[model samples]
Target: MGKENSSVLPVLQWLNRVVSEPHYLLHFLTFFSYFVIRCSATHILAPHLIHHLLQREIQTLLVFAVLALIKGVREETWEAFIADALFLAKICIFVLAFTMDRRLAIWYVLVFLVMHMLTQQPPFQGLGTSSKLTPLQLESLLTEGNTTRLWLVEFCASYSSGCIRSSQQFPELSITYSSKILSFGIVDLGLFPNAAEKFGISLSGCMGQLPTYILFDNATEVARFPELDFETTFFHPTVTKGLLSRHFDLDRSLLEYFNVK
Candidate 1:
């Protein structure tokens, strides 16, 4: 028994070390930024062209900063200086834009300010799409044995069809999915279980699944899932039931999509 306990200690120690490493910290920052930008773009800037441009500019700055860090290892000082200068330029441009146009600026500034404030705070650390669990949240969830809730919350918040396009532009801010028990269960069973059923796959204990499996791997295969099709299926009577029943104040475009009267 003592020998077994001693053997397990190093594994436990390694786990702790990996969890507390800097890479995890960077991952958290990346995901949080992506989540904030997505939410902001959908809610605040969807209709406005200028707001969209501003968001794109900020996103561009972030990309360069991340690239600098990745390439900086070989050319440390030069890369670091370039990254820092780009960051400072980003801030100055934002400030100048705000000062020049208060009305349009307010919308963009609010989004930028909120993200900046959130990033600076330690409590907001590691709160991202990748790991549904912040350190404290994970500890509590583990103690309570409520792993299912964690997966549900993350899926509802982070899983989006549009996120893939956005992540392509900003690789550092991409949300990664690891092959964990809870994540596999949610992706396989909860999000698109119907599709999986069609594929003759069981929901239990599946391994090495990728996100592309949730949707058909190609556009040709995608056409088969009628319910997944936004244009034709989204307006179906059965689909509109929930939206109409809840009496959501959606616009004409959205109402038309739901086939709501």
Candidate 2:
């Protein structure tokens, strides 16, 4: 449950921001006003059409829910299953309300649209954004006082085959593993001699062993991979992801996601 909470921290933060702001309350009021006006106009213009459309929308929502549930079952993860269940429940509630009262259905959909718009440009955009860190930035991160996060630092040369391969994998994995517990970054030895000096690796001498892995926990260096065969370690995303997962006590499900053998 602690791990789950860590993963969901960004979501909780987002909710807090939304509910805490006066602008969001104004947005809600605007949506409510529009929904009331629209529903009133509809009832005055065509009361008979409301019942007819409600049945059709309910039928469509039901069919979509069934298909989505089937797909979620095939996914075979607790998160997916729970998400599908919640989606079905939401649709059922909407359908029931639409059947009983048309005005409530208008309010529901308009409120949902307003919330979706609110979330389009989230405040915590950096939670999932990944970029290379220079020596100065990396040092700042270490001293930022947030000791709970995990940092994966890669020291690699520009021309190394292993570095090239890992570069392609890191961006995708950074997105896949975006959470409170994990971050990914790269340091190019070719670019920064000063940064390489801290790790005791000269830029000119890094050809034979081009890529090195270092893991940090609580702003302290916890693990450093020894110079290993590039083909078996640095070149493979699964091996890297799996090693980090095991070291940090992450879920085994990530192994399957990263295709770790």
Candidate 3:
């Protein structure tokens, strides 16, 4: 019974997530619509009508995919799965067309558009929006202070999915851990693209590895989240407060930071 309940928990959680989030539900409906449309088209509609509908749907998806590509409708040019919304949707339509029913393509495309617009990407703080930082300002702040100082700086872009996801957590950390020597700040690489060069991060649409968090000891670079392979994302861990705390040994660092002062 306990094992069964444990296995069932994930399904319940997924259902909760689906119901609570409109986008998730829309995606669910898109798939659900596919089955309904497929069954109706295959059984009720004439062969000619089904063929005509399938052809139209396929054509529509192709047109939209081309338009979306040219319009630069995606989040980034990396062509990553989730980050590029319309592109991902394009993939979904194609897969549904081929694997499930070609007639389902345009309906899912419409569903994708609705979900995209409804879940309008709110104005993310991006890299610089949270806290403004000029090169000179950053330089001055990094200099060793009178007390043992540590500055936790997050390098992020507003448009970056990873950056946006972790946006609230960083500020929350600032509220929790900020002190004279211990400080928290953000540099929006989106606003200061050149800053990416100095930090070995890229702002290029294809290569922008965002939300790089660096724990600075005075003027020196002490540590960073995702310290390895900041460029290639074979496996980029989701940036969370718990992950941040563990990576930088935050609790120990805080104790040491306070002990010195």
Top candidate when judged by lDDT against the true structure: 3
Q: Residue-wise lDDT of candidate 2 within 1-261, one digit each (tens)? A: 999998688467645665775434444454355446446756564566666756765686678778777965564333234334445645654664576468876776776666545532211123234557888887788767773266777677655534543444445456776555567777777788677768755354333445666767666887765444555343433225445455444453344335633
lDDT (tens digit, per residue) of candidate 1 on 1-261? 999998687457534543574433433454355446555655544467546566766775686667656654532222233334434544544553453345645655565556454432111123234433342453344345434321221111122222221212111121332112222112223455554454433333222111222221111122121234445333333112122223222133234434532
Highest TM-score scorer: 3
Instruction: State which candidate, 2 or 3, has the greater TM-score.
Output: 3
Off by over 4 Å in 1: 1-27, 54-261
Q: What is the lDDT of residue 46 in candidate 3?
A: 78
Task: Quote the lDDT for 170 in model 1.
Answer: 16
RMSD per model, one decimal = 21.5, 14.1, 10.0
Model 2 worst lDDT window (10 residues): 119-128
State every prediction's TM-score relative to the real structure. Answer: 0.20, 0.39, 0.55
lDDT of 3 by residue, 1-261 (tens): 999998688567656666776656666677566567677658877778677767866876687677667545432212222235435555755565654455555656676677777763322233321345675677788873664378788887766666654566777666667666577778888788888889877654455367788888877898876664745344566666677888888888778768978
Error of 3 at 33 (Å): 11
TM-score of 2: 0.39
Give lDDT per model, in order.
0.36, 0.56, 0.65
